[model samples]
Target chain A: MAILTGVSMQNRRPLTGWGRTNATVAEVIEVPNHEVAAAVKEAGPRGALVRGLGRSYGDAAQNAGGLVLRLLGSAHQAVLDPSLATVTVPAGVNLDELLRVLVPRGFFVPVTPGTRFVTIGGAIASDIHGKNHHVEGSFGNHVRALTLLLADGSTVVIGPQQQPELFWATIGGMGLTGVILDATVGLLPIETSRMSVDTTRIPDLDALFSAMSDGDDDFRYSVAWIDPQAKGRHLGRSVLGRGDHARLDQLGPKELLSPLAYGPKQLASVPPLVPPMGVINHATVAAFNEVWYRKAPLHREGELKGIAGFFHPLDMVSRWNRVYGSSGMVQYQFVVPFGEEEAMRTVIERLSVSGAASFLAVLKRFGAGNDSPLSFPAPGWTLALDVPGSARGLADLLHGLDRLVLDAGGRHYFAKDGRTTAAAIRQGYPRLEEWKAVRDSVDPEHVWQSDLSRRLGLTD
Target chain B: MDNALGEPQTILLLGGTSDIGLAIVREVLSPGARTVVLACRNVEKGELAAAGLRHGGLAVHVVHFNGSDTASHEQVIADVVAQHGDIDLAILAFAQLGDGAVTSKDVQAASEIAHVNFTGTVSATIAVANRMRGQGHGAIVMLSSVAGERVRAANPVYGGTKAGIDGFAQGLGDALAADGVHMMVVRPGFVHSAMTQGLKAAPFSTTPEQVAAVTAKGLRAGRRTVWAPGILRYVFSALRHVPGPVWRRLPLG
Candidate 1:
């Protein structure tokens, strides 16, 4: 096993996810290589867990009083298989790094989350789905095979055909089954790192849903930025954006020179000084929502944009989460199966009327659910919002949403969950017991654990 | 990291279970705070408080920290810094509010109060300042009281301790200003918190939430010293000039 060189070890290091909520302390060891198995074995009674770019947005990445393995320094390289359109790389390699390397080679990750900072391990662990979920299933569907380091110091190669149950469990398993070391992931071949986007401003919930249902099949990726503050007749008004990977012929003469060049730059960064109250109050969010809504073209087609511009606009501003002020923001993401549009609409109405002040509320259509029991998406409507953590009566409001989601036979995404109750989990995931059984079979000792796992009673 | 509105990503609360501390924390939580360290005398109580405040994606951690443990003040500060790097804000809201009768007559009681409210605070402030100075950026908020401005005969012992901490905090604030570390000394007038729940409501009394709001506003405005109700500033200024004989006769004592 290769030892992690230049990796620092710190005792009682405090950790939080991207959402900046539910902070916990752990002994963090930066695993530099496959030696992570040895490090896990050295963890005390609290056990050991792995953490990647820490983008789970909740306690999923945090292990309180336990040993946390940071894989940022883990020594693994991306090996591109151009012929097969697959890349076998270390799970610690983040999407941003992979994209930078792969895009020029006419290849892109099959699926990507909202941001590119997430590590491949985190993406697979959470089984992240992106705008293309309407067309492609999820990140898990693209994996060829993966090497998982299980408890009791053993490693196994698993895929759909090889150890199917454990393989599916590991996807969106929140890292409870084992540590994902490396994986061969199938990539999508693209001619350019640009998107041919179509923009439309829909007036209301009914119209937006109708438009999506009728036209979503025409595009590979589709999403809508809903104005949560919109009320009454204008309720659920959204700016719909649909796009597909741009081809070489679609580029202009200037762009055609280096069509695959990937340059995601930071335009601005939020400083590290939070004011007493955040800048994103009701008034500011309302105004921002209105401006953003108005800024979209009533109907525009064939608008070319960079991958970062279309997929991860927020990435342009590093530490943008600070905009919410010291009170961190809550990302509420729930998906109700198809034919449950009424429940989804009711939740949106509640959020709007409650004055939750979420400027980044989005609605997207999920194509279908995968075998991963805990995977967040299904063939349904998914709405995600960033609510200020300090909002008064937020917990009650979210709990209410959770109840609605559960009743609709929907579920909240564990990767973005912070305050979900155990009862909600039981109601949301009908196959949770099966997933738990598979997990227990692999790690009966419960070596892999996190604050989220403990909170949701996933670990006994 | 501070957001567009200048909200800190991390906060350190010395009196983790204190109502005032929690209120200030909640106020900060609205903007985009990421990590919170609740250091209190009772870890269990801190944990309970943490659970209540845990929402959104905020991460809350509780550690055993007794304000009266002057000998361990440095270690506590070190441990906090070591665990959580570059604490954006460190709130020294821990203090002992002894009974007026017991504090006035009992040497041990008065010593305990003085030790926790003044000596302990002083030691902790020094340790925090040193760490902040090294980090080159941090803020420290000390919870002082109006009683410190003009020590009244009613609770002279408690007032004396507050007075000592008030002066020490101000001096420390001035010293830290040069090091890019801000020190905010909050002079609230009889805050209605768990500590003062049973006591008579003093003039210009405020709630922990009100104090927290004012403290947050003060932090944003970059004010070194702030009075909770704002009116208390003028009231205290006028009362400070009152003749000692006349002050003693006032019913406030």
Candidate 2:
């Protein structure tokens, strides 16, 4: 816990999540770890919530009409213990900064989301998983212990061995349980910064599904880039990429010069000013999907790629969300059980028919989920897509998909959700009640709240 | 707590039974656990308007509101927020369309227009803005008449009222920009609603539904001002520079 400002102050700030929609205002306070307890105690009737890099793609980080605390955590203070294979990190520290320090030391985060801009707090709150979910599990699984500033203005350290119920509840609780101050996270010992990869172009959904199911577990990380526009025989056509951390011997002379060098590059950035209607549409997405698919090798093996190129290509463009236009953007990601292949295929078909125009649609397999009640993944296929908010009949289409997904025992990710009914959430997570009960026992006054909690009736 | 890609969770309609106001709400909202609060001087008319919008799952509440009584404004806004949490969107569609003959001679009509359309809205909207700013996220849509773009001579009193509120809404919108609350002014030209059903159809005359459609689009696009039928934006731009005498004499209808 750390927050030490001379005076207690608050700034009236309006903020929107990564998708840039549903802008909400709050009395934002920059709380040093020491002041976090005082800040939470002073939160008004609507209560308080903490925000990280504002990358949840929804209102998970917002607390309208209440207070929002930003913790003063930086990577400079992260203490890594190589002997114990653990790192004590402030919750506000993002992966980008942490990686800058760890990569040269031959280590990597146990789990990494699509974007490195996300903070350790958000990662646990959302319980984020990455390409290596099948091998490593979610962010919460690696979190050894964490400090939670409860609604009663009390700070407590919870972990798998201590107050396990509260620890699991807070993991994917969307910041409703309390504000996380810091965490002792386990790190993966890595050989080099580059990835030894495999790429294969599958002809259709059947081939893609089989390719992943047959051999994905053999690799440490795997994901597929989908072409939603390809219809009939080529429907769900994809380019599969699977890889493991490259060993020193696998690198060429040029790569050997600096095997552990890690500097994620920014090739270009989308400007702040973009058309209100956005530039992405059916035509643009179709062309992009075509070029992106063609650019990849038909069948490549052991291709050594940099960390940035493999894990976060989109990170190269700053404010890339602005390209979606002022109307805002909608990002939807969902996961169904492994046995529900038919349901997953139908969902993909519906999206294609709707012409979702998602240039970055991706599919990945998730391994067994942890005991966290609200965690999204549960040993299944997960698909993520970013669609323009202006998409025609989007609400109706998504609502329809919600029925289909829920009926097949699937659930939407709370982190990537901005528009889903409470009923849908209720149907998705059966353990929601158990998690809420644990949260209530700790803070019955319900001072910890967020817009997502209220929107989906998680805390209402 | 409202959905960005869908209809708002709650809406406050100032005009209560205003046709344009209800129409806009109808167009923007989809069926769900959504609430619409209607505020007007007459509770009966508000109930009647509420009946039309009472589809399955849509909750409509009628509250007493006197646009002329500026003192009661804050309470109206407070009551709605207290009962509904946060008013995601509000429509300032309540207006007294004074007699077109106010310029010739209609003292009572002029005062009514001034108090209700201009003064009442000024007070009520400011109250709403205050609460919304505290909430940190709300949208206010004021239904301004195209007549206000260049205060028309035919209906000077009504035109003058629209002009005042229109300017207020624009400035307030700019002020609220940093606060995250959005204020949009909708200028519809001669909309054929209950208020203007008997009146002669003017140039570029539209329907409440049409005005509502444009308003909904404006809110989505985050536009500060929107003209119904859209072409009126250019028409008013040219009319603003027209000579006073020549503008009055022109066969605008």
Candidate 3:
């Protein structure tokens, strides 16, 4: 076996999550093939962690002063098993690339996050969920098998049926167990890339919650945009949107010729230069929220919209995060169980009255969580908001929200987290010990480590 | 490589330990700027500053740079480029602010101030401009001052040096506009930094962070010049046109 060390192309660079909040320096090594096992074995005491597209909103992919293997450079083709409705793809392949190939073939990823920019490895590691999560579980549920490079420099094929303990641990393990080289994922068949969307305006928090609880099951996907600045009687007023893949008969004659064609185009791009303190302040966000709410139709149904328009509207603009400016922004996402409606209501009410400025506030109903110990979604309400990190009293506000969530039998999502505490993680995941035990057996030396694992004491 | 937030990946700080320079660096750090080269005459101080930024998870590189050493200015910029590739932004923030006594009576002090603040700035600016011009895209932020708008008799020599650099930076900005290189001249009122620790607070006095905020804002807007605290621009505009007798008697000094 050829040991490829020292002579490889490597540079010490800073790496940050999609949030662009906390950045750390690491030696990034570009792994061009499945022989990444050699690089993993040769990594120094700090060990090595794999990164794909750097889409995680936290330090999950960053390893300070250690080796970071960028697996995207590894060229591996995606093979489609047409009859089985499954596609085997390299871990480096991103969902956008996979979609380009699968969509034309009349299939779509079983699970896709808000943005298709995420790699398959990153999606599985984070166990990402989407709008359809209420109907189709997380990305981990559709994964049939994966080729993970163990800490001992040995490649192992693991699945839900084979080494289920390790498989579950690695699903939401944040790349601690091993590096995923490729995965076989089940795909969903689609008649067209367009979605039949329905939108409605809900007056208040009570109405919004009841509407989702009562009607969300009828649609395959559902989400709501809540106005955090709305107070008093208007508090939690939202524009609820529900969508499902449009059938052949649903399309007009003009769209029928190429119903299955999937092409997501960038309409505009945010300028690279960002002003200090950012452009999204309390006033701007409130104004934007109001305009967005009023502009949405009170009731609209069966509107045929492009896949990008229906899902991931923000993805149409490249570098849109720049709108937050140099201070960056924070995305707080948490899930509270079904019975904790009161707790969830209290949190939302507090945020609304606290004068906190959140640009994107989304509320979704999660159906059920998979077997992954740290999976974020549960059969309840999950609220996500993008608040400027520079906002005054943000830390205290989020800390208080964390306490509320924990008390309500809720936990924060690790993929969208940057500042959660170790004690919080412990209280959140009851099966953390079980996941760690399986991790220890596979990599007793803890060779696969990241800054996130270190911060949360997951390596110990 | 730009992060999702579009912040620069690399920055070069000419005056590594300057309060305003460090402040700007901190602001950009949040937007995912990773590599920083702190070039200063004081290696120990530069290393100390670099260490602080490193603690914040940035990759900091310290280099020996004497602002007054005009001959070595080109080499300093070349070295940084060779080591870190094209610098996304280069900050020219090295200057000497002499007191009243030195400005009026001390020839040696006045000469030293002129050499460091004006001539040195010219040297560094030219070197950075040449490299950025070759790269086809880069931003340079020059820290000018409100005192330069109209030299006050209170500190003639210090104000004179600033006046010289401010004019040069503005002209250079015009020259580089077509080359895809941008130059932003920030004119800030008295800033409460180590440089002006005991000085009386001037009208519209600001902090290094505030000045940094204005500079970042200006860079974003592609403005050729900006005023820290912003109100100072109106103040200076009206003050600049005042008769010499009236301006000298205003007690601004």
Tens-place lDDT per residue, model 1, A345-365, is: 899889989987888588999
Off by over 4 Å in 2: A1-10, A248-259, A274-279, B31-33, B102-106, B152-154, B251-253
Instruction: Kindly list the per-residue Cα lDDT of model 3 for residues A386-424, writing each as its tens digit.
Output: 877667667668878998999999998988887776667
Error of 2 at B22 (Å): 0.7
Ranking by TM-score: 2, 1, 3
Return the lDDT, model 3, position A215: 95
lDDT for residue A367 in candidate 3, whole number 0-100: 95
State the lDDT of candidate 1 residue by residue for B145-234, as single tens digits.
Answer: 998999877778889999999998888789766555778999999888789877888888899999999998888656899998999999
Q: What shift in Å separates residue A91 of candidate 1 from its native position after superposition? A: 0.8
| Residues B49-142 of candidate 3: C-alpha lDDT, one tens digit per residue | 9888885446799999999999999999999988776577899998878787766788888888889999999999999998865544568999
Higher-ranked by DockQ: 1 or 3? 1
Best to worst by lDDT, what's the order? 2, 1, 3
Best-fitting candidate, measured by DockQ? 2
User: For this target, which candidate reaches the highest TM-score against the unseen true structure?
Assistant: 2
- Which ranges of candidate 3 are over 4 A from the true structure? A1-10, A73-76, B1-253
- List TM-score per model, in order: 0.72, 0.93, 0.67
